[model samples]
Target: MTEAVHLATARVGDLAAVMRVMDAAFDPLFGEAWSGAQLLTLFALPSARVCLAWHGEEPCGFSAARIAGPESELLLLAVDPAWRGRGIGRLLLDDWQAWASAHGADDYFLEMRADNDAAHLYSRAGFVEVGRRAAYYRGNDGQMRDAITMRQRPSPKSGD
Candidate 1:
């Protein structure tokens, strides 16, 4: 967080950088990280969008999402552990929300494991609990965890 981190809209060519961030951010113990092939397929979709957070040429964080009609879903949000608590994740989320808003999306939706500490981050950003699925996640430790769904709706802008 020493240097200013900026966000950029990612294209298919930037998949490598995206994966690099994802691999570093997501712990190997969880075994939940996405593969390059899967990311490529997602990037090929019409509504797919990714916002990358960079710190002096290094990919520190990123958010992957899609916009469909009036609602948008945040498929993934990850920040390197070293960059955590430095506001990089929040910046990436802000960029994602702006991107979705520009695409005619008013309702923002996201789901995450109940045990994830990042829930506080989303909650501070105006997200409210909408639903939950029991035992929705199976960790590598063989424990079943619940999933929490959250929603955020930004008030409409004047003339928007």
Candidate 2:
């Protein structure tokens, strides 16, 4: 956590690095991690964005999102397990919100397994539970999990 970490917008060439982190971050049993081809398609979208985080020369975390009109949806936010509890995920979320704000997004949305521990992180970041989809995710283990949808709206200006 004390080590210097760098984060930047990721290009297509950074796919390998991104996937490396994704592989280490997401457990396959949950079936949350996306394939490289899926990521490549997202990279080709006009409204999509990807950010990669590095610890020295090693890629450690990443975030991806897409914007549509005044809203943006967080597609992914992952930190290598070894790099977790060190604020990388928070940094990625902050970066995404900043980027979304710059692009005129007023509301943000994301969904995760109802039992995900990351829910605490999102709650701390000001995202509020908005809805739920019953048995939305079918895990590789054949277990079904509810999806919790969360939303965050831009804070009003100080004067307002």
Candidate 3:
């Protein structure tokens, strides 16, 4: 049996580890790679928030979001290949929602590849499909795919 993973808000020092998880999670689906410098820029962004999942001090998963105006957008969420299906992703999502609500956000949103398997996770997390964009991503295999937009409204009292 596998042990439960631990989740926590990432500190500044965890940037590299978070970037590794992001790169691993997005590379296959997006094909557009994020360089270390770009990751650094993301980490440094004032509106960005990141949460990490750890299994004995090693980062096994992570989630990132940015708050702008009245909404928060989930930028990324990735779990280690070996740790997939263990609920770490859900934990990160839950954490992100709670944190965003606390920070005065009333709505949460995200965009994912229409064909990405992880769409189920967002759906289960209470995000409803609101729209889609055709030919949204050009995969490494030279194929175009649609992008799905999902959104969730926070509990009225929770955002106060």
RMSD of each: 2.3, 1.5, 2.8
Clashing pairs in 3: none
Candidate 3, residue 159: lDDT: 50
- Index of the highest-lDDT prediction: 2
For candidate 3, write residues 56-153 as lDDT tens digits: 87789988888987799998788877788888888889888888878878799999889888889988888999999999889988899999899997
For candidate 3, give the lDDT. 0.82
For candidate 2, report its TM-score: 0.95
- TM per candidate comes to 0.91, 0.95, 0.87
The lDDT per prediction is: 0.87, 0.93, 0.82
Q: Which ten residues in a row have the lowest lDDT in candidate 3?
A: 27-36
TM-score of 3: 0.87
Give stretches of model 1 more than 4 Å off: 154-160
Flag clash pairs in model 1: none
Task: Please say which candidate is ahead in lDDT: 2 or 3.
Answer: 2
